[model samples]
Target: MSSSTVSRNSLEADQQWLLRSSSPENDLDRDERPSKPRRHIVAVLCLVLMFTVAGYVTSSVLLNNRLEHPFRIPKLPHEEPCDFAPSRPSWNSMPRHRRHAFISAVQRLASKPSRLGLSNTSMYDDFVYVHTKVVWQVHHHAISLPFHRYFVHIFEQALQNDGGYDGLMPYWDWTQDSSDPLASIVWDPWAGFGSAGNGCISDGVFARVGKFANYTENGYEPHCVTRNCLAHADAVDESDGVMHSKHWTPAIVKAIIDDSTTYRDFRQRLEEGPHKHLHAYGIGGDMASASSPNGQFIPQPKHTLSRIP
Candidate 1:
């Protein structure tokens, strides 16, 4: 061992030690390095959350829109080809005579076939037979108001039987209510219907109002006719507030009676009559008549206007 050889060997050994230590540390550092894959995963989660929020916002908007408007019901496929057929054209499409016939029929159905006060008849018309208990309770002794659904159905059926309704069955929803006591637009408010040939008209407000007697007495009161009945129930002549004779005056009774021929004449005249301003101040729109509920106006030559004698 020369001194130069010993120095060379020492330098080589030191180099080897340094290389081993550096290699291990470099390997560990590489092994501990973070991957880009984890970042991509975080990005995906954030996107999902955003979409979920967007979906919720969209749903809320749709729900609000639905609440504001009338929901459009989806139409189902018709059972028959003509099941969805449009009914005959509205009032204008009807022939003059056919219109008259339809009107006459309506009157007959509205008025009982026979009675003692208006005209003499052997039969006592049973108005409550077709009525529901709810309606009967309201109008037992009173005149029955026609039911809306029943009236519309019967009116449509009669019109079809006559080859088609010459005129549309006019509608009149009583617009008055307790919440809106002063609101009497009286949109063509001659009338609308129930079980009776003439509708149940005790105090003329309808079952919803209960009975007028209930006002004075606390509990449910038996129904009774009142002079304060709805204006339509009182008289077509708007001038007369509500004329009352214990028995209605024969002349007025005759005027109100709705038999076959007379009914036809009455409706024709009414439709033809000048739609006088129901209110003095406001310009009046066209005056329209409402159909009797359940009972229809069907033309019958022999039919009389009233059950009265």
Candidate 2:
């Protein structure tokens, strides 16, 4: 063998060795080896992503259901629809017979004994007692109009249930009589609330009763339903600093109705403005008192009955 032939044989051997070292089996052994920790981390990440998606879907479904059926209250099976709405007529518009019936009912209520365990001697006194008790809270607050509205309602219920009065509550439209309150037809002896007398009311349906219950300066005591309707300029000036008779006018009422946006504003305007004015001038006796007299011409009823219903 020559030297050149020996050298060629050695190069061929080196080439064969290089091919074996770079084989697919060797690469597979190095690169395709499975790592247990990496496999566990990938599996955990996949599970977490699946659970997160499922949880989001479930929450969205539940929220939609809640929004669709927010209120779970059950409807009554035997509920009857109310069809009748009682008409609240003005005092002047009310029929004479109905007026008489209302007066009779009020008298009956006044005559009955008080259910409230206060020093109240009669049902009328019970009303006075309640008014006096909660006057401070209910007068100037947001609840003033609503409180009075309900108060009138309870009284009406009493008249209906106890006194057998079927007629609706009669509201005194003081706007009509604001100009000449004393000469108003409501004070008529025959057809309306009787005119004011010396101390106790000497006329009208309220008159001729022996005594009124829970009427006193200090405490509850039996007394007559009294009035001092004679207007004193000095006293009037002192109370409000004006002698002019202030009552609800259509313009004033319209302004209040139109301007007042919130319930609080509406209530404050009404309770402070028209209501106070009427009470000050209308039946100035027990009507003005903190613990006012039970009997009057008519319980100055509200014209609009919005708050009652």
Candidate 3:
């Protein structure tokens, strides 16, 4: 109750004091824990974050150079008065009967341009006349190819004589690329503006004369050429106006089929009649220059010859 009791009581008091000081009860205990950032450091971090965001936004803006749209180039126009040296024997140089026959034949073509052949069909009559005229003029040495202007005039006349044209004549729309410079002829039905050929290169009849016999204008043209003239179509099918030599009229073929004897005799007479004249009067090259292993006759020659300025 004296010395021992007093010593025990002092030890208990010292233990309690040590526990309270070490158990987060003193300021020194708080100092031992991690401290929060200073306001200045927080402000500096916020400023750096803001600057980084602003820089990203600025970089994004710079990367996208504002342009409304893309750029494009244009094409050039075509040259006129198509380049072709006129051959001998002016279209008018022929006798009146001969000229009338040729003219009549061409005029007739406009009315029945499409013809029955064994495997294909030709263009409609008016188009046929114009196209054939061009081909013949180019290939036939005794004929001169017409300029584009006179060709147009003859075309107009042909149409008028056939009871006036309601629409424009179909033209070879050579705007697109040509597969062969020497043997290619392109035509678009909707190539002209307004009335029939409006916005299209077709006028209900157009034939793609090449390795592929396609009718882009009307699916009927190729049929006519193929069905009636199988032999002629096959031999000179690939050739343009300058290559085809043999031309068979529907009447002739029909007559031949009807009566072989009469047909043969008539064909023989027809051949012999014009054989010498054509052979002797060509531009020094005979029909050979106009010949193609696989070709059609050159068209529009008389049109060229009619209006030589």
Q: Report the number of the highest-TM-score candidate.
A: 2
Worst 10 residues of 1 by lDDT: 280-289
RMSD after Cα superposition, model 1: 39.1
Work out the TM-score per prediction: 0.23, 0.65, 0.21
Error of 3 at 51 (Å): 94
- lDDT by residue for model 1 (131-176), tens: 2222212111111121223223443544343324355443211111
lDDT of 2 by residue, 1-309 (tens): 764454344333333433443345422223222244533443333222222311222434443434221122113233588687666777877778888888888778776776554444766566666665544444454434554665566667677766778976677776666556567667777678676533566676556666754655356667766554544222344333322255456666767788989766776577556665555443445555555535443556343423223
Task: State which candidate, 1 or 2, has the greater lDDT.
Answer: 2
Q: What's the distance in Å from true for residue 224, model 2?
A: 2.0
Q: Estimate, for each residue in 100-145, the C-alpha lDDT of model 3 and write its tens digit.
A: 3433433344334332231343222323323332332222121112
Candidate 3 residue spans exceeding 4 A from truth: 1-142, 147-152, 161-163, 166-170, 173-176, 179-223, 226-309
Task: Give stretches of model 1 more than 4 Å off.
Answer: 1-102, 110-128, 132-151, 159-165, 173-309
